[model samples]
Target: MVLAAAGCSENAMYDLDGGAMDAAVVEARSLEIVGDPTVSLAGGDTADLTVQLRDPSGAPLAGETVRFALDGRAHDSTLETVTATTDAMGLAHSALQAGTVVAAFRVRASADDAASVSFDVAVGDAGFGSMQVTPEYVGERETLPRVVVGLFADADCEDDFVRRDPGDRLQVLSEDDELVRFLGLPAGVSFAVAVRAEGEGGTVLAWGCEDRIAVEALETTDVDVTFDDEPLVVDGSYQTTSVFPTTTGEDVATALEGARDALLPASDATLILDAAEATLSGAEATELRAARASGFDATYQTALESLGPAAAHEALIDRLRTELTSLTVVGRLRATEGELDFSVLRLGMGAGELEVALTELTIETSLDATLDSEELRVSELLIDLSASELVRALATREAFDRLLDGPSAWLASAASCAALPPPEEPIGCDAVCLQAACRTVLADYWTAALTVIEALDQERSTLELDGSANVADLAGDLQVDTLEGSLAGEWTGPSATSPEALEGTFSGERITPPR
Candidate 1:
């Protein structure tokens, strides 16, 4: 008694003897939920879960039966799944209806020869809540490049939120943004919210956390996070008296200061020595020319002009040798902003004496700063010569005057002498010959003096420090590190140069109140 099968599909064909026959055998190779793996639902709500069945080549395998099942018995009582058949597009649809109680469950889909996928369905009492977070930066409100707002299960946020895994619901806000929203968070339960503010380099600039924040099932929770700069421990008085040049590496401040310190001494010494040489050379040369013109030797006049000037240069050099280079910054960072009393022990020349004085300085602008739990960050530190300018204005004129004053007085005295004697005899003096020699000596003296003034001016404004530094506490003081920048600018004395790399480290201790 043989039966015949009719209307067989492409996946299965019937044999002539009425037995089922394998025609085009297609097995499910992969299965995945059509949409998001996680879904939120209120009590007694239903959501459609769709799964796609695919072959080895990812072509849809139609007419396949996909069984929708729950993983454990815990979810067996709260939620249930239904079986469905794959359509022509290899998609199977199933319905998930939550029970009266609010609970969470995972739905699994299985097909023959295909890996199963899961859907995390969270059921809340009534509905879900949306969290809107607003962040306010208290100091130097620069735009934060990255803001991560995390919503964690109240238990996981008990400890350090930064060390935990990315929370149950995490969302990143756009750069320089002030607000972020997290939608569809499970409601009727306490949650801990943690926010992290980051710079462009992804360094964590600020952190804020709030716990036991409750969200009504249907209401939007408005939360505020304050990233106050006051937490950085930089508000008190700090005095950085030690000028430790930690590295000769690529740092603008170090290179500029170092180059000035190194060059000033050599330059001053060279200037004094050159002044003597110029006076001697100018006097003798002028005497020679005057003697030939006047038909007699003018050696006595030359000796008078060049004598006793060694005492002045010797005193100047001695004063410069005892000078010390030091940096002292005394100030307070009140509410992350304040002015600093800045001073640097610098070498200067004034009033016929070498000046080793404390140069009062000021920054070019207010500090562009941000303070966090770890450190205070400054965008750049530019040391400007407020004191140097005053000295340059006052001492430049006076020093140059004194430089020519002594020489000019000597020249004038020699010129005005009317003692009667011919250039042929050394009994008295030839006033005309003496005046000519004095003129030549004064010309060379003024040239050397001007060179010294220009050299001092060139080094005056060279302390431009570029780059950023992290300032933190070290044994109750401020420790600064990681400074890097370049030193290059037009020399005020007429020279062009390229930037040289510089680096260094310095620390300061609190010397005043609030220590």
Candidate 2:
């Protein structure tokens, strides 16, 4: 009976052990996260997660199926109802992938009657920096009422790139304490920034830019920009080459010199007139009259002799007809006080009379100009012909006929002159004929005088000028409407102390005096 009872006890113990194992499997009612309950991941990255199955006695339960359910969805990776069987260690493994946004998501794991365990995952990047700018103005900030800042992807600041919305721009207002911050900038990318300030009437008061600023992950960059109230001044010299108008075959320089030479003796007559002014009584008066008459005669003779022949007369007239179509004047420029001042120290006309007389005439002119990008504009030009002594010398010749015509005509016809009959008590028809002949010659002198004045008038008025200047060369065109013509030219002068030179050519129709 004792042996039988012992055997029955052993069988009962084995059955009890099997029943405990079955109960343990049925009692696994909860899932617990094996490691950290929360995981952090960058966008487009993944994290491994594990959940353990446990019984009511806190013992591991194997071969149970665990399922995962995510609160949110990503563009990539499986985060829905994913199922995995627990291994011998009672752990089920899964992976959670992050999307392209920065946020937090919840993930829950459960098995049969087990209570679900919740886990959190943060999806985003923390590798961005900040940028701040301090803007400076030449005047008060109040004078600049508005400011705008722009960011670009190119060194030239062209308005393209995807760092921001296409139409979005930044305005740093004084009311906002002038602090600006940008977050989530991608690392290792180049950027450019620009700033502009608006004044009263919406005018742009100041502007500046930073062409290249590299933003790094987890860093901050500081920049400063300045806007100046004063105008920019560019001081430099230029060189040029030129060609003149070829409308007329005559040389322009020769015409000017001829006019000058014709008036030389007449200019000297002023001295004789000054001496005669003091000796105006009886015999002295007679002597003065005779001296005056002789002077008049001599002047007429000199003028006639100068004409040389009919061909010479025509040559002089042809020279006067030649128009200056092209001219080049190169010099240094000093821009300041809202004006560009151009000083032409050297100028050359063709290799004719004008070139020879340049030293003696001292021709010079000043231009008030404005500059834009690569262009130079002449706003006003000051050319003073009266400043030249040679020009002043022309005054006597201009009035020559008025001063000497009467005296010269009287002396030639009344005195013993072969060209007329002897003067009677009153000058008769024969004397009149001789006087008319003399007047004919005086008409030619007047014609020459008028031509010189007309040419000189071109230098006395405002001119329209357009041109451009670059690092290598400078060029321009000058138009004088009153002269009915234009001059185009170019110049070169790289050195400041050395000289800038210019050359140009001209074009125009021949000018004829009114009949």
Candidate 3:
């Protein structure tokens, strides 16, 4: 279990300058629990808890309302005072009664927007045991941020322990060389232990495994896990020789059209119609009229006009296919996880005045090895889109006007106007107000676009290889043979979305030594 500490929460009030406003105008800046972080008590024992609330300059904030809540089951554990106001010392107090059951729980103290902290409480006799793990290689290297310990059922230590469920694991956020402990584990069971050193970006740098250890009730199990002398690494390059046949231009067009229509909810139709009347006229107004009669194709044309012909959308998909089939992918193995980065692809229209940029695709790989089985599972793919850049370039009012070539100019001669002219302006008319609405419409369009991009990001495909190697080999140049795999859409285990196993072979070869 991770013991959380009280941290400072930002509540900045800025004046006209970027500098912070006066501290008197700010609320509580931090909230800290003053009692012990861990409490061990027999059943029916009571513990008093106190929290302090402070302002920006570390001054006491008196009379502020503080709230207390329980996180997990402490059996029938109850907090006597659920709420309390701070005293002159910025402290608030509450009491917790340890109930008639043996369980572990946490008490959380919070106040308004101030940061919160939690304390672990265990109410039991001698039935529970603790595991204390120390890494053997930490003294020889730099400190890491976190150490993850997993208790697995595999006695021989063959299973992928990193992917195990929550109840059997402990992740302690700390600097290297600190002893990590897991409390409240059931005793008298022989289990394997997996320990990994997590560095920046949560990357596993070193790992060790030990098997067949028994724990005794009411006592602490001390174990030392020996990790790699140094972090393992691999550098290489690979590429896809062929694109997935199922990926099509029609799919791209359908995604774009769906994103466009989602922005025009029924309630906003009247607002869009009024803005359209004030901004679009002459040939453009007539174009929309004839298109809306054709059904859903009308909404597609409305957004597509600024993007050019329907064929342009198809061309972009063709470019995506070409880039995947031809580009060389750079890869690296940072300890256990393998990452493949694809080259950036640029899809453009209107002589490159409007462009959408596609960046790298990262593929995570896992190696499994045992006497009976040796395989590598590569999945968890993410395709990064230039959504923010696209919004700035194409989803703004200025871009709309540039693409349509000043449609508001034709509004002057139009007979029916949905809005009145602004004061002190004759020809300005509702064109300015209509433009403001146009900004809202475009903002909604990009919001929908971002939603589509997020879904696309989660859409993963899987591939597998038929063999694995010792973890030490990852520090040098490593290569894998051609392997067959499957392609699927957003697969979580097996379901309707899982596709048939596709026929293809891709291999990897390392190019550089460990970084």
Q: How accurate is candidate 3 locally (lDDT)?
A: 0.46
For each candidate, what is the lDDT? 0.46, 0.43, 0.46
| Model 1 local distance difference test score | 0.46
TM-scores of the candidates in the order shown: 0.33, 0.26, 0.35
Off by over 4 Å in 3: 1-28, 127-131, 135-145, 148-173, 181-221, 225-515
Per-residue C-alpha lDDT of model 3 across residues 357-474, encoded as one tens digit per residue: 2222233434332211123344433323222232233222233433433213212112112232222322222345544544444444445545664443233233322322322233
Tens-digit lDDT track for model 1 on 271-361? Answer: 2223333444455555544544663323343433433223223322332232212222222333324433334433232223222232223
lDDT of 1 at 442: 37
Clashes of 1: 6
Compared with the true structure, model 2 gives a TM-score of 0.26
Instruction: Evaluate residue 251 in candidate 2 and report its C-alpha lDDT on the 0 to 100 scale.
Output: 34
RMSD of each: 19.5, 28.4, 21.6
The sequence of per-residue lDDT tens digits that candidate 2 reaches over residues 90-184 is 89988887777544335667678654555645455665444676666664333454555544432344533321221112334343355444443
